[model samples]
Target: MELRYSPFDFTVHEDPYPFYARLREEAPVYHNEKDGFWALSRHADVLAAFRDDRRFSSRNGIRIEEPFWGPQAEQFFSFVAMDPPKHTRMRGLVNKAFTPRRIAALEPRLLEIARAHLEPLLEGEEFDLIDFAAKYPTDVISELVGVPESDREQVREISFAVMHAPEEGDGQMHEGSTDAMGALIGYYAQLTAERARRPQDDLLSGLLQVSENEDRLTPEEVIGVLVLLIGAGSETTMLLLGNAWHAAWKHPAERERAFAGRIEDWIEETLRYDPVSQSSPRTTTEDVELHGVTIPAGEKVLLLSGAANRDPRAFPDPDRFDLDRDTGGHLAFGNGRHHCLGAPLARLEARLALTELAATVADYEIDEAAAKRVHTSINRGFVSLPTRVTARR
Candidate 1:
């Protein structure tokens, strides 16, 4: 049976692992000439591609082959799509903004936010985790980035537009598409200017403080970083929490064990089982041959991190979602330099959210009919997951 892989296909979106497994075993260097791209689906190949930044670069926007965003769009995301030196400098400055201390300091508030959103629905009644999961993380991160409480909803709307643009728009740069992006950047730019005038105890002010030899990010770059932070930090985390809950609900034994004790294992196993980010786009800088297949330079090569995580060559009995399995080093978060910037914060949020779910809800019933998986170019998770939670005695 020949397997076909399409990024925009709903069937593929609903479940892509079986096809991904075939890509690993049959066509490790799978090429989709129709979509005009190539993909590396195995663990070794994808990891190598990530390490070989010289050959496979992120310079050309990381959303398949997308014309490397126009000048205006570039200003808002150039740092993400650039190679070292430029990437290094931008990352260094941005690191100061997203400091360990900053995230650590926010833990109390993070937990509080998680509970605040969760407490209202923990009465053992039927409620969709998706509804609450979507906004809690966004609210927490937006406040940290200095977004006004009044504007968080607007920020979230923009984030959703950005995440879905690949599917809704031309899948690449198009006129008027940057309007939402512009709104997001304009909002952050205003915040950035305000921070410059009067500093605040927030990420925006921290960015203002991070200077390298009198060098600083332009307002555009700061806006870029903030935009990326909210977009990357919100949807992925939201879906992750949802995916973890859905995964637990599928595995009763594991769910039972998780309820009895720790939920960290559940998070780990869920990430390995159903990652939010199925792949990360990387463009080939030059022609490359892998697993007896030749891929021309400039061809978009997606490191299918989601597929690689399930490779039986790297994992034992890959299909089984076992909590006891040592799922350490899974590429649920990408590998190499472009590894997820907000991984620690993501883990912390999931820990708190799942821990609360386990503590407050005795057990839950998933209405699979109402549950819908997110169908987008580069995202995966439940869009609507209605559940019936039994109140804890």
Candidate 2:
């Protein structure tokens, strides 16, 4: 069979479900010669890949393309690319801030932030949901992570530039990420220095205080943790808000059901039907066999999360958005050990954003023709989605 690459073709990005459905049937584990990578499209296969650490290693790195910063990129962003022991150690320190109770406590604050942005929209004729709705979660996450409100925009801008940087080159990709990353690293380093001088109650201070039997996180490790937390926590939430709203406007009935306090099902349905982040890459540590295909060691593997989420064998009427289907097993947050550490936080942000929007914005619609998509190998969301919304009774 000929190799099939998904992200390269703009047509596929436009409507990937049809092609994804075909992939589920023909090539659950697909090898694309064009990109020199393998893609897994079925839920079972993707989940298996996510769980099997020894066979499919993250050491070759998680990104599909080379890091813009060259070798340093791996050092700075290697948390996601690490295997057990190191993965466990790094994740343990950072995971403290994202506990269920902590995220649950954030709901009221998130709701307040959502309400604050939405109130101005009520008086205005129209506003961009991507600016307000999508931005709400970033603000909330920043606050939770101890980022000053004034610096949040700068942080988000840096993240946006790097996260949505074009796949075609690595020049601006490195420069932009390096500058933004420098700002973040400097901010955290200064913060850590201050904490050392005069400690306080915050996530950073808490991180500074954590010691793992003489394995405490170094300043560099602290920077890495903060970088990972801020970007992952904020960006994914923003995407979920944007993606969910886009899906709701596309399906009016689904929107109505969602507005009526019937959101859990619809949100999960939307995730399975149209997830924000599609694929995450992994590398093979050894030669692997899948359905008669031989994938050589040290090759890149892309786990098509969005494609697998909509696999027909797993979800009936996979292309259709049915608010009633069971979508709990979707790979929207990935699976197993490296599953999204902020899954609870991301879910809370989306649930609150979608539910609050449905309740407050009595009538709203996305400007389909004008809406733009942010193209990246990993993250998928909107660049701008001008939406018109009215206040509810």
Candidate 3:
């Protein structure tokens, strides 16, 4: 069979590792003439590309879909879509608000939030893990960003609409997604203005007040950051929790280890074994030659981090979901200057949420036949995992 790969292909979404494996061995510099993008699947190649920002530009954003791609990507992706200087400045201002102190302070609140969602489900015999997965991170991020509890559900719905891509489309933003993006922008614009008028002890107000000498974030930039946070911060963690749950359920021994206080290993291994973010998009800044293939300048390229994590060169027995392996350099949160800013929060949320689950639930099972996966351009995970738990005595 001819080796072909497209991020929008549903079949690829079902199991991209095989396709990624083929690309790594047969066509490390695979090009899809139909999708009009090139890909790198080798561990070393993708890692090097991530570190070579000068060569692999982020000016076109990290997604290869329409409307979200191109120069205006900053409107949605904020500093994530920018090259250095611009990216550096924007990220600097935002970092003050995203301090380690702030994140650590949220730990107590995060536990409260997790228990609030998990306790109810524990009272029942069976429930969809997605319900808890979807709600927990939305609330955690909302609480951090100062979104009113009243509006969190609405915000979650809008974020979902924005992240969702129709399984049948050609990777274009549907009208519904367009409207959701508009609505999210409008909501954040109003929130930014309100925070400016009445500063609070929250990230939104911190962003408004953060300044570096004469430089500060514009209201528009603040709004952009919020939208980026709600989308990236919320959705990715939501899927990560779901992926962690599903991974554990599939491997009972590892699941038992996770339940026996190996929470951190479980999270790290899940991240390496089956990351929620499968790929990241970049545009070439100059012609680059690799493996005797010359990729032209300004062409769209995908660094298949999903495949890289599973490379045999990087990990022995890459297919196994063992809780004991050294998952050191996985590109789950990516690499370089563009590494995910929300990584700490994402890990904290997953650790705490899963810890709470492990403490209370002795064992769990996911209805594999009933599990439904989320369809998106760059993300991979379940949207519905029908799960049943056994309470620890």
lDDT of 3: 0.91
Top lDDT hit: 3
Candidate 3: clashing pairs of residues: none
Candidate 3 residue-wise lDDT, 1-393, digit = tens: 988788988888788889988998999999999989999999999999999999999999976678889999999899999999999999999998899999999999999999999898899889998889888988898899999989988988888788763545487767888789999999989888899999999999999999999999999999989888877888899899998998898899999999999999999999999999999999999999999999999999999899999999999999999999999989999999999999999999999999999998988878889988887778999888998888889
The CA lDDT at 342 in model 2 is 74
True-vs-predicted CA distance for residue 222, candidate 3, Å: 0.5
lDDT scores of the candidates, listed in order: 0.80, 0.73, 0.91
| TM-score of candidate 3 to 2 decimals | 0.98
Q: What shift in Å separates residue 130 of candidate 3 from its native position after superposition?
A: 0.8
Winner on lDDT between 1 and 3 is 3
User: What is the total number of backbone clashes in candidate 1?
Assistant: 0
Name the lDDT of candidate 2: 0.73
Candidate 1 per-residue lDDT, tens place, 171-223, comes to: 55443345676777787888888888998899988887888899987776887
Candidate 2 per-residue lDDT over residues 1-393, each given as its tens digit: 453555656556667777777787887778777567788888889989989988876765545555432234445564676888888888887766446776677678778887887777667757887787456766776667677778878766766664565555321244565566677677767766776677665667667778767767776777777777666676677777778888888888988888888877766877788887788788788899988888899887888998888877788777787788888788988888888777777777778777767776787877889988766566677878898876777
User: How do all models score by TM-score?
Assistant: 0.94, 0.92, 0.98
142: Cα error in model 1, Å: 1.3
Sort all candidates by TM-score, best to worst. Answer: 3, 1, 2
